[model samples]
Target: MLVLFLIATTSSVGFAQIYDLGGMYTYHYRDGRYSDWGDFSLHGSRIAIDELNESGVLGGARIRMTNENTIDYHCWPENAALMAETLMKKGILVLTGAGCSGPAVDIARVAEKYKIPVISNGSNASMLSSAEEFPYFVRVVSPSEQYEGYLINVAAHFGVEEIAYFYTTDAWGLGARDVIHEYTQQRDINIAQEYSYPRDTPYDEIKSYMNKVKQAGIRHIVNTSPTPDTVMIFRALHELEMNEPGYSFYAAEMISADEAPEVVAGSLGYFAPMVELVPSPKLSQFRDALEKRLGKPVDPSSKAFFYGALSYDHMLAVGYAIRDIQDAGESVTSQNMMTYLRRMDFDGTTGHVSLVRGTNDRANMPIQIVNSHGYKDNGTTVDFVSVGRVDPATGELILNEDSIVWPGNVTTPPKQ
Candidate 1:
C-alpha cells in the first residue's frame, strides 16, 4: 500500500490572493538512506517561499504551499502520479519536488496530461530531456547523459582501453547505462562486461558480482548507482581487496565524503549541473541564511547541499516566472508560467540557472570531476577535491593531473 506523507509548511504572509504551488517528494525512503535529501530540499523550498513573499516579488500575489499540498511520495511512481493529480485538482500553477528520477518521471507525465509545469531539483534521467514527450517538465540539474561524456573522458585519461560497467535496474541507473554505452562506443572504448543489479540486491550478491569482475581481470570500472548502493559496492570491493592500486573506480553519482570514506578513497566521480559557487556577497548571505534555517553548517562540497541549493533555485525560477507574467499585464496561468520558465536566465545559488531552448534540461551547466582523496589542508581527513571539470562553455575536459590522488594513495593514474 502506498502512503502519502505531508510536510508542514513554514509561515506565510497573509494575502487576499495566493498562488498555489504543490510539491511531491520522497521524504522517507524505505531504508531511510535518502531522507536527509528530502528534508533539506523542503527546507530550502520553504526558505525561498518566505523570502519571495516578504520581498514582494509578486506585488499583491503571494505563493502558498500548504502542509496539505506538499505530499511525500516515498520515491514511488504510483504515489507520485496520484499525489500530482490530487494537487492539480486544487489548481496549482506549478508542481515542484520529485527528488528522484522515478517519481520525477511519473509527476512529469501527470503534469503533461494536465498541461501544467513541473520543476525538479533532483531528477536527472536522460529520457526527461525529450521536450515533445514532457513539454511541461523542466529541471534545475543537467540530465544523466551529460555526465557520461566526462566518465568516458576520465577512462581515456587513465589509458583505459576497456571497462567493466555496473548499474542498477532503475530509471536513473538504466538511463546512465544507455548513455555510457553510446559514449564509450563513440570513443572506441571497449566495455569488457556489463552487470546490472536490482536496487535492493543483498550484500553477498554484490560481493559475488565483485568477485566475477575480479575474475575477469577488469581494472577499470564504472558504476552508475545511487549513493547508498554505491556504498555497498565499495564495501564489496574493499572486502575483495580490489580497491587498490591498478584498479580504478568511477561513479555516476556523488557520494558523501563521510560515507565509507576508507573504501571509496581515491575513486573518481562527477556530479552534474554544478560549478564552484562564485563568491559574491549575495551568495555568502544566502549560505548564512540557509545554514541558520537548517541549523547546520552548509558544506558546499556535499551532495545534499547541492540538492538544497537546486531546490532553492527551483522556487526562485517559479517565482520569477510568475513575476514576469504579472509584469506583462497577464494573468498568472500554467501556460504563462511555462513561457517564462523556458526563457529563465538568472544567477541562482547553484550558479547561473537557465533552461535549454527546446529541451527541459538546464543549459551550460558544468560537470565537475572529483577525486576522493585526503584533503591536502588536513591530510588525515578524506574529502572530495576538484581534480577536473567539463567546461560549460567549451565542453572541454580539463584535468589537473598532478593534483589527483589516485587509488592506493598514489599521485598518478593507475595503469590498467
Candidate 2:
C-alpha cells in the first residue's frame, strides 16, 4: 500500500524566474514511532524540489513547501484531517502526503470536501483505486498486489503447497490480505490457517499466538503484518526455539531484523525493494548526494526506486502535471492540476510513473526477492541479500541462486 503524494505545475526549460506554488508534507503513523518509508519519502521530495529549482522546471518558478506532522497513533485521521482543513483554510489547495494508510483516508475526505486535489503516497487499499470514491486522491506508489504476488510466486515456484498467513487489521494489512487471498487461490497454494492482530495488540497476546502457531504444525509462514508485531512474533519464536529448523518465515518489511538482530537469523526472508544491485550512475549520484546531505549512510530499503525514493517520483509527477496544465493555457488549481495529472507521465528516480490510466498507481516496478544469507562478524551483522526478482510486468520469479538459504543454514524451502 502507498503511504505518500503532492501536485504542482511544470515550466518551460527557458523560464528563468521563480514562482510560488503551495506544497506540504503530511504524515501520521499508527503509533508514536516514525515510518522509514515516510521519512525517506520526505527526503526524496526535498531532493526533487532542489533539482527542480536548479533546473528551472517551473519557468522561473519554484515551489515553496512546508510540513505538517499530525500527532495520532490509532489510525484515527482526526488530527490529520484537521491538519488538512487548516492548510485548505490557508489557501493551500494541493498537498502530497498522509504517509500512513488510515490518515490518508481522512485527508482524502478533506480534499473532496474542499473540492481540491490531493496527491498522496498514503493508503494503498485497493478500494481506494476507485476514482468515483476518491476523485481528489492519487498515489505515486505501486499497488499492494505487487508485493503479494512476489510472495505467492516464490512460494509456488518452490513447490510449496500449503502456507500460513499473518496480517494486520488496518488498511495496508487488509489490502495486502485481500491480494494474498486472490493470488493464493490463483496459484493453488492453500492457506493452512490465518492469524491477525490490531494496531495496538499486546506482546503477551502475540506470545500466545505463537503457542497456537507451533501447535498448528505449520512450516512456512507468510507474514505481512506491522513491523513491531512481526518483531514480537519472531522473538517469541526465537525464545521458544521455534527458529530451530524446518521453519520458514518471510516478510515484506525490509528492516525487520534491525532492532532484533538476534531473533532473525537464518529463518527470515523479505522483499528487497527499489534498489538495483548494479546501480545506475544517476542513482549512484543521487544516493551519494543524499547521504552527504543526511550526514549519514542512506538506506535503500525505504525506497521507491533508487535509495527508497517515492516522493521523488511523486514530486516530479506534480511538476509534469503542472506543466501540462500550463501548456493548455490553464491556471494551476486543484481541478486543473488533477486534470493534467491524469495525462501526465514521466520517468524519474522511481522508474516509470503514470496516473493517466485513471489510477494513482506506478507501473512496471519490480519487487526484488531477498533471502537471509545468515549473519557474520559474530552474529552482529544482518545479512539479507537479493536472491531473485519478481517482475511486475511479466510476473516471473527469477532467482539469482539455484537454491535459497533458509534459517539454520538450510538451503531449501522447508518441507511440509
Candidate 3:
C-alpha cells in the first residue's frame, strides 16, 4: 500500500527523461501482524534516490520508484512473481526487494524471465547463491553459508564439544542447518541432538522441545529460526529454567533486541553480516535524515536499521550501473544494467561492496557477532552490543571476551 514517486529537476536545455524502478516490500502479514522493516527499507532506497538526483549523476535522467506492498501475501512465492510481472509491464528498468527468502526466490525468477536486475537486502538463502539458477538476481547481504561458521567457532572458543541444533523446516532454516552441519564436521564439533520445527510452532510446543533438550542434558544449543520464533525459543528456555549460567545458545539469525529483551538477555549472541554503525558525521547525518523521515528516533542497535544500510547500498549499486551506462553513451537497458552490476565494486555505506562474478553475492563481507543485554552506561536500558566478529577475508572468529556479559550478568563464559 506504499507508493512513492520521485522526480528530478533537469536543466532548461533538455527535457527530463524518466525511468521506472520497482519495489516489492513486506509491510505486514496476512494475519494483520505489522512490521516496520518494509518502511525502513523503503526510506533507505529513497535516500539513495535523493542523492542520485541531487548529485546529477544521470544528467537529464530522473528515476521514478514505485513500491508494492506484499500484504496478505507476505513471503508467498506466487504473489511476488506476480507483483514483479505487474511492475515489468510498466517498463521498470530494475527491481528491488521481496525481503523474505520465499518471495525473494520467485522475484528472482521473474527477473530472469524479464532480463532485469533485481537486488535485495534481506534474502540470504544459500540456494540463491547459484548463478545458474538466478542470473539477474543480486543481494547486498551475504548468504547463510557466509556466517554459519561463527556458530561453530563460538562453540569451539568456549570448549564446547557437543551442542543441540534447532532449526525451522524452511528454506532459510534448512539452508543454515546444512551449512552449520558442514562447519561443525570441519571443526570436529558434535551435534548431540537435532530438532526441526515447523514455522509458527506455538510456544507450548517449543517448551516441549526444550524439555527434550533438557532431558538430553544438552546445555549448548545453536538455533537457526526466524527472529520471532527465536524469541519464543528464548521464552521457552526461560520458563524451563534453562537460561542459567551454564546454558549457551548461539543463533544464526539476528534476534530483535526490542522484542523480548528480558528473555534473550543472557544467552550466546547471534551472527549478523551488517555494518556496525560507528560514530561518524556521515552516520549522524544518515540517522538524522532517517529519523526525520520516520518521525521517530532511530535505534542504532536494531537489525532493521542495519538492513536500511544494505538497502541504501542496493540502490546505490543500481545508480552506479546507470551512471556507467550513460557515461559510455549507451542506452540504459536491462541487459546493460546487469552487465555492469555483475562486476560492480565500490565503497558503500555498509563497507567495501563487491559482487562475486558468478553468484552475484557480496564477497568477503564481515560478520558481526552481537548479544543483547543491559547497556553498560545504564543497566536498565537493554540493547545489542558487539562482542566479537568474523573476519571477512580469513573467516577467523575474534571475540572481545572481556566485553561480553553472560547470563545473570556473569563475566565469565558458562562451564560446559
Candidate 4:
C-alpha cells in the first residue's frame, strides 16, 4: 500500500501542467523469502522524474506518480488485472515495474483495455516481444528469445559442448526453460539435462537434482531462476563440494553481478563467465544522476547498481512520451502514448531503444558476453573482474585466458 506521487515541477504548477503516472509493483514472498525489488524501481523512477524537472522538459508541467503494489498473492493474471484496472481508473497510463512475467502479462491485458503503457525493466518474458499480444506493454530489458540465441552461442565459444538448462516452474522460469531448450536444440547443442523443479522446492531437493546432473557430466551449466533461488542453489553446491576447478556456470543475465545481493558473493555459482548490457551515452547521463543521488558509482561495471540503468530508461521514456503529449496539445490517453512511444527514438539512459516498426519489440543495444569471474572472501566483497568480451555480431568471446580465476585458487581458464 505504499504509493508515492512524484510531482516534477519546482513550484507553482497549474493543475493542467502535471501528468499522473502509475507504478504497479510486483512485490511479495516466494518460497520463504521477501524480495523488495519494487523499492528499486520506485526509487529509480523518482530519480528520473526529478532529473526531467531539473532539465525543464515539462516547461512547468510536473509528473505526479501513484504507486500500486500487487502483493503477487497467486502469481497469476487476476492479481495483475486488479492492480492495473485500479491504476487506469485513476487516469494513469504510463506505469512502471511489473518485475515478472505473469503479472506483466496480465498488466498488459489491462493496458490494452485502457490504452495505457506498462513499462518495466524486469519484464523479459519472451512473449512480451509480440506486438499483437501485449501492445501496450513495453519493457526496457531485452527479451529472453533475443538473448537466448546469443547466450547459447556465447556458451559454445567457451568450449562448452555439453550444457544443462535448469529452471523453476514459475512463468518466467518455464518460459526460459522452454525457449533455451528450443534454441539449443536448433543449434544441435547437447542439452545434457533439462532439470525442472517447483518454484518452492527446498534447497536440499535442488541439490539432489544437481547431483543427478553432476553424474551426467554437465561441466558447464546455465541456470535460469530467480536470484534468491540461484543464491540458495549456489549455497547447496558449495556445501556439496560440487563447485570445483572444472565447473562453470551462468545465472540470470538480466540481473547484473553488481546488483546481486551480498549472500551471492562467496558462492561459487555466482562467480563465472559474464554478459554485459550497454545503454546509450544519453541514457548513461540520466543513469549517472540517479547513481550519484543514490551514492553509487555511475560506471556500468561498478556493480553497485544492476537493474537501475534499464529501469532508469523506462522512467525517461515515460517522461519523454508525456512531454511529447503536452507539447503536441493532445490528451494524455493510452492511444496517444502508444503512438508516440512506438514512433519515439532517442538515446535514453539505457541506450538507443527503438520500438521496432509494426512490432512492439525494442531494437535493443548490442549485448556482450564477457569472460568474467569473481572471487569473494566474504559476503560483501567480490573480486569481480572481466578479462574479455564477446563480439555480439560474431559471438566470439575474446578472453584473456591468463586472467581467469579458476576454483582451487587457480588463475587460468580450464584447458579447452
Model 1 lDDT tens row, 1-416: 12222221212333246899998866676566556667778888998999999998888788989999898777665566888999998899999888788668878888888988999987889989988988889998888877766878778877888988888887788898888889898878999888898776787998788889899998888888776677777778777777677777778766654554545543423222234455667567677878999787766666666677778889999999988988889988998888889888988887889988899999988677777764435443336677778878888888888777665666656765
Instruction: State the lDDT of candidate 4 residue by residue for 321-404, as single tens digits.
Output: 878888999877778887777766777655576676676566644554433344344543345555556454564546555665
State the number of backbone clashes in model 2: 25
Candidate 1 lDDT (Cα, whole model)?
Answer: 0.77
Per-candidate Cα RMSD to the true structure, in Å, reads 7.1, 7.4, 5.4, 6.2
Rank the candidate models, highest lDDT first: 1, 3, 2, 4
Ranking under TM-score, best-scoring first? Answer: 1, 3, 2, 4
lDDT for position 227 in model 2:
57
Task: Give TM-scores for every candidate, taking all chains together and pairing residue i with residue i.
Answer: 0.89, 0.84, 0.89, 0.82
List where candidate 4 sits over 4 angstroms from the true fold.
1-13, 26-38, 67-78, 254-288, 295-304, 370-372, 375-379, 387-403, 407-409
In model 3, which regions exceed 4 Å deviation? 1-15, 29-31, 67-78, 261-274, 277-281, 374-382
Task: Compare candidates 2 and 3 on TM-score and give the better one.
Answer: 3
In model 4, the clashing pairs are 6-65, 115-334, 258-303, 279-350, 280-350, 280-351, 283-348, 283-349
Lowest summed lDDT across 10 adjacent residues in model 4 is found at 1-10
Which candidate achieves the best lDDT against the true structure? 1
In candidate 3, which residue pairs clash?
Answer: none
Q: Each prediction's Cα lDDT score?
A: 0.77, 0.64, 0.74, 0.63
List, residue by residue over 1-416, the lDDT tens digit for candidate 2. 13222222223434534333344343334555555555565677777778877785666556656544222233444476777777777666467655556567677788889877777654556666767888887887666676666777777776778888888887777887898899899989899889887865787887777777778887777877655566666677667667655776667555432445645642444333323334556567667767876788754533322333656667777777766766777777777777776665776655566763767665566467766665644565456677787666687778875546775566655666
